[model samples]
Target: MDDDVERAARKVRDVEQAVSEHVTRGGPVTGRASSPDGAVTVVATPGGPPQSVEVSAAALRMGPHGLAAEIMRIADRAQRNANTRLHQTLERVVDPRELTAMGIERGTDDDESGWRR
Candidate 1:
C-alpha cells in the first residue's frame, strides 16, 4: 500500500513539473492567421498574448471600426489555431484517458480544430 502511494505521489510531481516547463517555454507551438482581405494577420500561442500582429496599409481603407473588427476576427482565429496546437502538444505529454476524463477530447471528421469540451 505504501509503495503504491509513493508511486502515485511521484507521478503527480512529474506531471506538475512537465506542465510548468511547457507553460514557461512560451512556444514550441504557435498559430498564425490572416484576414481574408490580407489586411490583418495575427500570430498567437496558447495561454499567451499574441506573439505578433501585422496590419497592412490596405487595412486602413476599412476605417477604424472595420479594421478593429477584422483584427478581432483574425485574432480569434489565430487563438483557436493555437489552442488546437496546444491540445495536440498536451496529448503527447499527458495521458489520453486523463484528458477524456476531464471532458477534453479531439474533434471528429466534422471538426478539424482538434479540440472539444
Candidate 2:
C-alpha cells in the first residue's frame, strides 16, 4: 500500500483501539443531590443502577405526608442532578448548538438573559 493509505489505516486502527479501551474501562457517571433540610439525599447515574436513597431519622419524624413530599423532592433533585451531569457529559461529546439550530428547545425560558427553568 501507498504511504498515505498505510497512515490512514493506522489512524483508523488507533481510533478503534481507543474506542474499545474507553468502552471497556469507563464507569457510569453519577451525581448526588441533597434536600434543603438535609433530611433526604439521593444519588443517581445516567446509564446504570441508581444509588441507594438515604433518609435521616429527622426526616421520618416529619410525619407521613411530609415524608412523602420529601421523598418526591429528593427524587426530583436527584434526577435533576443526574440530568445536569449527563448534559455536561454529552455536551463534551455533542454540540448543543446543533440541537438548538434543529429547533429542539428543552425547558427553555423566555427570558433573554439566562434564567433557570
Candidate 3:
C-alpha cells in the first residue's frame, strides 16, 4: 500500500514537472498556414489567434479586397492547425484513460462539446 502511494505521488509530481516545463518553455502548440499561391503565411497560437502574418510582394499586388480575403482564409487554416496541435499536446501530457476515469470528456480541441463535461 505504501509503495502504491509513493508511486502515485511520484506520478503526480512528474506530471506537474512536465506541465511546468511546457508552460515555461512555451510548448510547440502553434499552427501555421499559407495561401494557395504561397503569397501569404500565418502563424497562430493554440486558441486560434494569430501571432504573426507574412505577406509576400506578390500577395500585395492583389489589392485590398483580394488580399484581405486571402488573409482571412489563411488565418482560418492557421487556427485549425493550432487547434490540432493543442489537442496533440494535451494527449501527450495526460492519458485519455486517466481523463475518462476522472469523468472528464476527451474531445478534439476543435470541438466545443468534447472539451466540456
Candidate 4:
C-alpha cells in the first residue's frame, strides 16, 4: 500500500514538472478584435493575458446594433482561437489522467475523463 502511494506521488510529481517546463516553452497567444467600423478594438490573450476591455458607442459608424454584433463576433473568434492554442499546448505535456490527479477535470460528467497512461 505504501509503495503504491509512493508510486502515485512520484508520477504526480513528474507530471507537475513536465507541465511547469512545458509552459515555459512558449509565449502566450494573443488576439485582437475590432468593431465593424474598425472603431472599437478588443485585445485578448486567453491563456495568460486578460479579463480586461472597454466598450463605447464611439465605435459605431454603422450605429449601435451593428457595433454590438461586431463586438460579439470578434470576441467569439478570439475566445475560440485562445482555446485552440491552450488545448494544443496542454496536449504536449499533460495527459487527461495527470489533470485528473491534479483535480482538473474536463468534459461532461456523463462522458468521463482522464487518460490511459
By lDDT, who's the top model here? 1
**Model 4 lDDT tens row, 8-34:** 999889977876677666654444555
* Candidate 1 segments exceeding 4 Å error: 1-13, 16-27, 96-117
Off by over 4 Å in 3: 1-18, 22-26, 94-117
Q: Predictions ranked by TM-score, top down?
A: 1, 3, 2, 4
Top candidate by TM-score:
1
Q: What is the lDDT of residue 42 in candidate 3?
A: 84
- Per-residue lDDT tens digits for candidate 1, residues 1-117, read 999999999998998789668756744676677876679988876667888899999789999999999988888777677666666667867987786565444433232342222
Give the alpha-carbon lDDT of every model.
Answer: 0.72, 0.58, 0.69, 0.55
> Could you tell me how far off, in angstroms, the CA of residue 88 lies in candidate 2 after the best superposition?
0.8
Q: Candidate 1 deviates by what RMSD?
A: 6.3
| Model 2, TM vs. native | 0.55
Candidate 2 Cα errors over 4 Å, as ranges = 1-26, 47-49, 97-117
TM-score against native, each model: 0.64, 0.55, 0.60, 0.49
Q: Is candidate 1 or candidate 2 better by lDDT?
A: 1
lDDT for model 2, please.
Answer: 0.58
lDDT of 4 at 17: 83
TM-score of candidate 4 against the unseen true structure: 0.49
Give lDDT tens digits, candidate 2, residues 17-108. 75455534554545566777779877765444457678998888989998888877766556555545545444543466643453322332
